[model samples]
Target: MNRSAAEKEYEVNYYEIDYNEKLLITGLVNYFGDIATRHFENVGGSLTYSKEKGMAWVLYKWNIDINRYPKYGQKIKVRTNAYSFRKFYGYRTFEAFDEKDNIIARANSIWLLIDTNKRRILRIGEDMYKIFGLTKKDNKPLFIKKVKLPEKFSIEKSFNVRYSDIDTNRHVNNVKYIDWILETIPLDIILKYTIKHINITYEKEALYGEKIKIFTELKKQDEEGYISLHKIVDEKGKELSVIEAIWGIEEK
Candidate 1:
């Protein structure tokens, strides 16, 4: 694949920014989603397969690194391309850049072709693989570190799903889950810090009207007062997801 290919540009909209006037993390995910969907449409692939078959492309995992966040009025270009494929999964990469072409963020994700009706992973059909033109590569993805739950982590808040939390798939969207977890922290803490890393695992789907309990624990705080630890639990008290968020004071 040519890394120098012209990047696909997208205009920033009012709805895409958060109260802080920067693109929300969820908004960034949606942009990537849009790019992937358009790529499929160009190749004559179906984007609504999940709705038709009761199966959808559920995000199994993702690792995102951002050098800086885009401001509200900035016009950014997001370039995405599929690099490789494995049995039931396809690997893809994306880059978000400013109009001047400075890279702002990059991500690598693992997507599972799922059978929504049966709630199981579906094998990648040969026809689907051919459509995307993906090949096997010798390089491996960055191995995300997993942490074991401490003996005594506790729930901070419990929330019930509102209509707004559900996406077209009738399940909680990946970014919404992140928002929910972040909301558990104090606003003062959120404003004073910058996220250095986040590692999340999607365990199961939480449907509308399900009551979810969010559990969090402070595993450690460094000399600079940066916070890090495990976050988990959903409405049913089941382990819906696990995340490790590292934070540091924003430099002056």
Candidate 2:
């Protein structure tokens, strides 16, 4: 079954917004994930089918840019497409648009299909490509700069993985990592700036009941904006994920 991109519409709920009444980044990510799953199901890769086959697609990296945060009660449309596939990787794009059809946020991501039973990445066969309607493309890199860890972190905090943080996959959901990273950011930056860009690379997974530490460094700050780096590590200090964030001055 060949299909183009798929889309879904959603309304920003009151619970999805932050204290400032703007949609939270994690809420937007939920919408993106929902659309991607629905699109895959539309293409015949239903969650049930994948589970029965002991297969699952795991996020490897994220590059998201937000133009402006949508307010509560606003309606937005999300679109996603599986654009390219490599041996063991899939490349996809997602966009969120306002009621006026203007894009408010866009993201590019990399995913790896893995054998759930074996816990290893599986090669993308021709069948997988046909199912997703993916075509080969030139390997122009999707990301310009890689997410880098800070040379030394100034602030660090540790937390135990909560049951609620675990998703259907039996591991902490990707978005939960963002929540952990945000906790270490300076309160001043969180209050005075709005996140405009985010880049995250997943290295490992965290399971329930495990303790994890987040190290954050405010690398740069000026009149225009701020840059923050975060690293999540397991109890043994094993790297789980690294993130870089860019924030712009909040409009007064």
Candidate 3:
């Protein structure tokens, strides 16, 4: 079977905006996921396993690059397409544009098929391959590099995972983890800065009962005062995820 492309549009909602009155970065990512998931489900694909003994899709990694932030009450069109499949992984690409067709952000993600019962990776089945029309691509997807946090990082805030933080998978959702890490930075810093790139590595799952320690370190790279390093660690001091965010002043 051959894989095909899917695209959808969305209007920025009030609830999706951040305190800065712009679409929340994390919320934007969630919207992309929601639309993409719906597109697959409409075609009889499963984002998570159902009762009939099937597997679900799990995000293995994502590379997101933002050019500009979307404002509240803006209508944005998000285009998504299934590009390829390899063994247990499916590669998808997403592009977001404003009403005028200006590109806001673009992302590429690798998803793994997982067996719900066995908690193991599953190969792409014939049915899904046919439905999604999975095919082979010539070039490899661009992957964000995972940088380790420096040893001199200092803890700025600590947070305990709440029940609300847990997703249907019973683990902290990826976006929420990014939110927690962002909360450690001051508002002034956020308002004046724009995130150019973010790369995160999911090491271990954070359960509801676990407390997360947030640490951050900033450094100047050329003219950009980048938030060079960020990390989340469990109660036992084991790292959960390491994120490196590069930021610069919004271009006039």
Evaluated with lDDT, which candidate comes out highest? Answer: 2
Better of 2 and 3 by lDDT: 2
Candidate 2 Cα deviation (angstroms), residue 75? 0.3
What's model 2's lDDT at 10? 95
The reply for model 1, stretches above 4 Å from the true place, is: 1-7, 49-54, 136-142, 219-225, 249-252
lDDT values, one for every candidate? 0.70, 0.87, 0.77
How far residue 106's Cα lies from its native spot in candidate 3, in Å, is: 0.8
The C-alpha RMSD of each candidate to the native structure, in angstroms, is: 3.1, 1.7, 2.5
* Best TM-score among the predictions, by candidate number: 2
Candidate 1 achieves a global lDDT of 0.70
Candidate 1 lDDT over 47-123, as tens digits, reads: 57546656666777777776666778888999887655677776677889988989887877777778777778988
Q: Which of the two candidates, 1 or 3, achieves a greater TM-score against the reference?
A: 3
Point out the worst 10-residue segment of candidate 2 by lDDT: 135-144
Ranking of all candidate structures by their TM-score, best first: 2, 3, 1
Per-residue alpha-carbon lDDT of candidate 3 for residues 78-105, written as tens digits (9 for 90 to 100): 8888777777767788899989999989
Superposed model 3: Cα runs more than 4 Å off = 1-3, 47-51, 136-141
Per-candidate clashes come to 6, 0, 3
